[model samples]
Target: MTVDVDFHHGDTIDAVFPEADVRVQVGFAAPYAAAVNYGSDPHWPPLTPMVRWTNKLGWENYDLQEADSEDALWQKVDNRRAAGDPLPGAYHLAAHIAENGTKPMLYASDAFIEASQRGEKWLEGRGYDAETPVVEIARDFANWSLELANDNLVSRVSAASDGNLQRSAFPAKVIAK
Candidate 1:
C-alpha cells in the first residue's frame, strides 16, 4: 500500500491546522500589559476592561476557537472577566499563565494533521510503529506555531511608537522576515 502526503504546498499558515481547532493563550498579565503600553501601536489599545479586571480580580482562561481572530480573542477575554470568577493577585495571575500557558497543546492545522495521518498509514504499511513519527510531526507543528506567535509578538512590539529594538524579547530584524 502506498500513501501520499501533502503539506499544503508550502503554505505554512494554512497547512498547520486550518480545518482543525486551535486554542492559544492570550493574557493581559503585566508583561503583556507592558508590551501593549510600551511596545504595541496606539491604535491597538489593550483591552481596558480585561486589564482592569485582571488587575483587580486576577486572570481567567479565555478559551478561543481556531476561527477567532486577535480581536475576537480579546473580546472573549473581556466577556469572561466581566462574568466574575475566583480572582487572584497580579503575581498569581502571572504564575497561572506561566504554568498553564501551553496546556492542552496548541492544536495543529487540519492539513498538518491530515498529512501526519497519511504518514502514519505509510509507516504502518512499512511495518513500523507510527507513534514516534506522528508525535515528532505533531511536535514540529507545535513548534512552528510557537515561532509564528513569537515572531508576531516581536513585530507588534517593534511597530509601537514607544518600542525600542533593544527591549524586544526576540530580535526585531528576524521578526520582519
Candidate 2:
C-alpha cells in the first residue's frame, strides 16, 4: 500500500539532484503529491493549506491584468479565502476542485514520462549505477524523477514545498519497525 522513501530536500528540490541513496525505495508523503502523479481515493482535504497559499502568494503581480488593478485582484482573492479557490491568470478563477479528491494529472504524468525518456537517452553508455537495489522494480521512477526532471536545458526541480504551511522534511529514523 505504501513504499517508504528515505528522502530529504531543502526549501525545494532545485537543479541539482540524485544524492546517493544506497537504499532506494518508493512511497509518497502527501495525498496531493500522489494524486497529482497517480490519482487518489476520495478524501476531504483540510482547507488550511489552501488558505495559507492564498495569503502567501495571492498578491503577487501576474502577467495578465485583472478587473481594475492589483488592489482589485487582492480584493477578489480575499473574497474567496474561505474556499481558497485560486484565480488563474487574466483574472480568471480556476475551476474549483470541489470537496472530492483531485483527479490524477495526466499532463504531469505525460510530461514526467517524456522527461524519463530523455534521461534514458543520456544515461545510456554512462554505466552509472550507484547500487540501486530497486532499479529493476522502479527504474522509470528512479530514472525520470531521481535522475532527470530539470528544465529542457536544465534538470527539473523535484521536492514539494510546504509553502506557508511551514513544515519541511527533517532527519529521522523509525524507532519501531
Candidate 3:
C-alpha cells in the first residue's frame, strides 16, 4: 500500500499544514534504528490496582510520591532497565500510562482523513494527478493518518516495531479489520 509522491514547485508539507504544529527532520542517510515518542508527558498517578500489583512485587517507585520525586524517578528508570523493561519501552510505557488513565492519543484529524485529503490535494495542486498517492515516512503522522483512516494504526505501528504486544498497551480496543 505504498504511495508514490512527486513534489512540484517545492511545495512541502509545511505549506500544506501551515498554522499547524509540525516538525520535520531530514537527513542524508537513514539511521540503523528508529524511535519516536510523541504524546502527553507522563506522570505517576495515584495508586491504582496496577500500581498496587506492581508494588506487591517490590518494584521501586511504586508509590506516587517516589515516582514524582526527581531523584527517585531516575532510580525507578534504572530499576526498570535492570529488570529489562527499558525507558521508551513502548509497550510497558503505554501500558503503565493506560493503567493511570492517561492513554496515548492520535488526533483523528491529524492522523486520519483530513491529512490524507490534504496530502492528495497538495500533490494535485502541484501538478500531480488527483489520484497520485502521497508518500510519507513509515512512522510519520501522514502515514499513520492514512493507516488510522483504515483502522490499522495500531497493527501497522506494532508490526513495524516487532509485534502487537505494544498494541495491547493502547487503552482503546483494537478495531477488527
Top-lDDT candidate index: 2
Q: What is the lDDT of candidate 3?
A: 0.37
Q: Over all chains combined, what TM-score does candidate 3 have?
A: 0.22
Give the runs in model 2 whose Cα sits over 4 Å from its true position.
1-24, 38-44, 59-95, 99-104, 125-177
Best of the two (1, 2) by lDDT: 2
Q: What is the TM-score of each candidate against the true structure?
A: 0.23, 0.35, 0.22
Compute the lDDT of residue 40 as modeled in candidate 1.
30
lDDT of candidate 2?
Answer: 0.38
For each candidate in turn, give its C-alpha RMSD to the true structure in angstroms: 16.9, 12.6, 14.6
- Select the stronger candidate by lDDT from 2 and 3: 2
Candidate 1 per-residue lDDT, tens place, 60-86, comes to: 434643345657756665665688743
Write model 2 residue lDDT over 99-129, tens digit each, in one string: 3545554433454566446645545544546
Error of 2 at 145 (Å): 1.7
Specify the highest-TM-score model's number: 2
lDDT of 3 at 137: 27
